[model samples]
Target: MRFTTQRKRFRDLSEQEIIALAISSEEDDAQIYRGYAESLRADYPASARIFDGMASEEDDHRARLIALHQQRFGSTIPLIRREHVAGYYTRRPVWLVENLGLDRIREEAEAMERDAERFYVAAAARTTDADTRRLLGDLAAAEAGHQESASDLANRHLDADTRSNEDATARRQFILTWVQPGLAGLMDGSVSTLAPIFATAFATQDTWTTFLVGVAASVGAGISMGFTEAASDDGELSGRGSPLKRGLASGIMTTVGGLGHALPYLITDFWTATILAFVIVFFELWAIAWIQNRYMETPFFRAAFQVVLGGALVLAAGILIGSG
Candidate 1:
């Protein structure tokens, strides 16, 4: 996916073409670093400063590479880049990378340095010309130096306390944006649909009919829950993060929770499907308990007791009602 084309091999490039490619690569890297800086500027200012420093360093590298190109081959640089070179590493779009997390962005920055260094080393090996080989070796050294510089840059911008706080804040944001909403959705879907689903199952004694009812219950509940969560808070005041993200987490998990038991009813045999559905319901209740224990930090046994007892009561009620 990273390779757009394999038209030009590394060994095939002339010294002038290689210089042009290096210059363009530096320019693109600088632009990407700047994009990262802009992306993290608001929430994580310290991290943004680190990226800003990196961007500035990349600009300096580009300028140096351009000067070298001018001195060696007289200014009219060729339009060569990573995409033109076979086996050259390319950068992921900044917008996409930034969406991963704070830690991931930092890792990506480090990876960029390593990728550049490796490319330069590989280019050096491919070139027969002494000057070009040496030039590439120097470029490789410069990229390796960037790793040290990045450490110094981070030290200047991010103190231990600040880094710890930023990481904690990011974790909290993740929990608020995804885990909490998803847990709530899973709980609602698994517990709320039990009565109607089981009652219909017992009453009809028809696997196909039961499956239909279960699907309707699950999907309807999922949609209602998703919209309710999204509309409940805009995340402006609550600090829960994006409405869209929370809605997606809630909606997807809600559907999954209900479908766990519902899917078992697809079997043609009535008793077989019903037995499987019951087994699935047992696991769903336990899973809800586990999630509560894990993320919500509820006592495991207490959560299990509450979930299992409530589910059992509901199931019993459904069976009694169906029998009558």
Candidate 2:
């Protein structure tokens, strides 16, 4: 005999169990919608209103499901949930929804309703009980109606101008939360580590020693930048998003930036490693300039001039110090 833990299949669930699951799913969806509403209320009020309306629709569905359960299966509802049933649709966390951007949340909401509609239709087919089947059919139709009317709801709450404004806000939030911090980290790691790494290379004339110094400098800088960024802002007022995410972006990019030039020191020949490191440093500066031009909207030539000049000065200082 084989012993295994397995979830109950959807088709194996009884009418009462199915109804109970439906009620629970509706409750979960309603809570999720409300969470989306609350999270977006501060930054994107228009989008928040749409979520609020969607939550209201979910509440209506939940009330009807409960009323039907009371009429047929009595006041006590079963404790079954999506987790109890195999192959059931699962919802993503509400926090993830907020991070997915405003438009993506709308798309997810639409998909959630469609999933509900499909589940109910399937449940209606599996059940033999008249009342249960009827209830499932009604819920399916309600979900379909919600999907159909979703566009109308958006039109009512989010007009063209409001939508555009909301999109701009969402973009700005993304830049602030992820891009800006990451770019800062990259710049710091690339430029700041350049001098030390090159200076060590010139001073030591040993590939292994240069590589070790570069690794230590890069790793240290990454740790410092990550912690600094996370501690600098809680994101309550700045709306930059979760500190952990920002810290990760900053830290990872910083490490990458430093590692770019650092890795070249693996070459045994001093001149070869020095040449490759210089090449890597040159590209890193250009990349920093390009990012500034693209995301920060700084003028291309101006950014290039600023970055290249500063990087050259640092490079020169390192070479001179090492040579001395």
Candidate 3:
């Protein structure tokens, strides 16, 4: 009962706290847009202009908030953030932002404006002071107007060719950041783990032993691949992301890929486990092929042939080696 009361208190924040949170959030978003603009200035000049416009808007909002704060409370405002509120939503990191497609970024921008509008509207409703309420209402209307204004700004800056190029660039970055590492992990897990798992299965002819071997192989491959990927590239030229994040994503996916087949070995019958493992392998290969074609822009037939053929060769090698 005491714990429930404390949780309720943690969940509810005052109007002043909410206002402070909104101010901090807007400032952070403005900085993020500025960073994006700077990063894209050379390759996507048109998109940079859009971010510049957004940054200006954020600056205007911040100025208005500062004025209001000075009039209402004091000279200095306390630093409060989204994390201070128990249930507040958090923004995505800048590295992750680089992977978003143009259309998705536009949609996200629109959503941000809408969220700001809603926050202002709710704040206005909560305020008891007439001046504060009026100011908040005005801000809400401004936020609502931002959605259309952003679209107009984007259209003015970005011609069809520029938009298309930016989209293509964004897609390429997505592949480099996420798909390539993930594919490497999946391939390593699915192929490399096979020999150790199968060797133990044949050697012991015991289901539990086989399962243990499979788990060990899957986990070991995941750690080795993760560290190797992280250490191999510092991402200076690639612009993928932090090596740690990329490594974690790749490593986790790799473990999952191997464990999918390995878990079936717990069935206690060699033939049943073997059949299930084969089925999982087939699905894994198809998934890899699809990802290559869809995200990496590889031709469907070529991607299919390459992935399936390579996977088959790896599978054959693992079997031959294990048998020996």
Which has the greatest TM-score? 1
Q: For residues 1-324, what per-residue lDDT tens digits would candidate 1 score against the true structure?
A: 584554698878888888788888888988988888888888899999988888888888889888988998897999998888878899998888987789999999999999999988987897788988998999999899888889999999899999998998888888899999998888888887788778888898887888888899889988988898899999998989889889988988888888887888889888898788889888989998988888778999999999999888888887777767
Steric collisions counted per model? 0, 0, 0
Clashing residue pairs in candidate 2 are: none
Q: Let me know the TM-score candidate 2 reaches against the reference structure.
A: 0.88
TM-score of candidate 3 against the unseen true structure: 0.76
Per-residue CA lDDT of model 2 for 1-324, tens digit only, reads: 866548898778777787788889988988998998998898788888888888888788789889988988899998998888888999998877777788889888988998988988997897787977887898899999887666677888899999899889988988998999999999989988888898999998999999999999989999999999999999988788889989988988898899999999999999999899889888998999998998899999999999999888988898899989
The predictions' CA RMSDs to the true structure, in order, are: 2.9, 2.8, 4.5
Candidate 3 ranges beyond 4 A from true positions: 1-29, 39-43, 61-108, 125-132, 238-241, 297-306, 313-324
lDDT (0-100) at residue 47 of candidate 3? 83
Which candidate would rank higher by TM-score, 1 or 2?
Answer: 1
How big is the positional error of residue 92 in model 1, measured in Å on the Cα after superposition? 1.2
Write down the lDDT of every candidate, Cα atoms only.
0.87, 0.88, 0.76
**Candidate closest to the true structure, highest lDDT:** 2
Of the pair 1 and 3, which is ahead by lDDT? Answer: 1
Worst 10 residues of 2 by lDDT: 2-11
* Candidate number that wins on lDDT, 2 or 3: 2
Looking at candidate 3, the ten consecutive residues that score lowest on lDDT are: 3-12
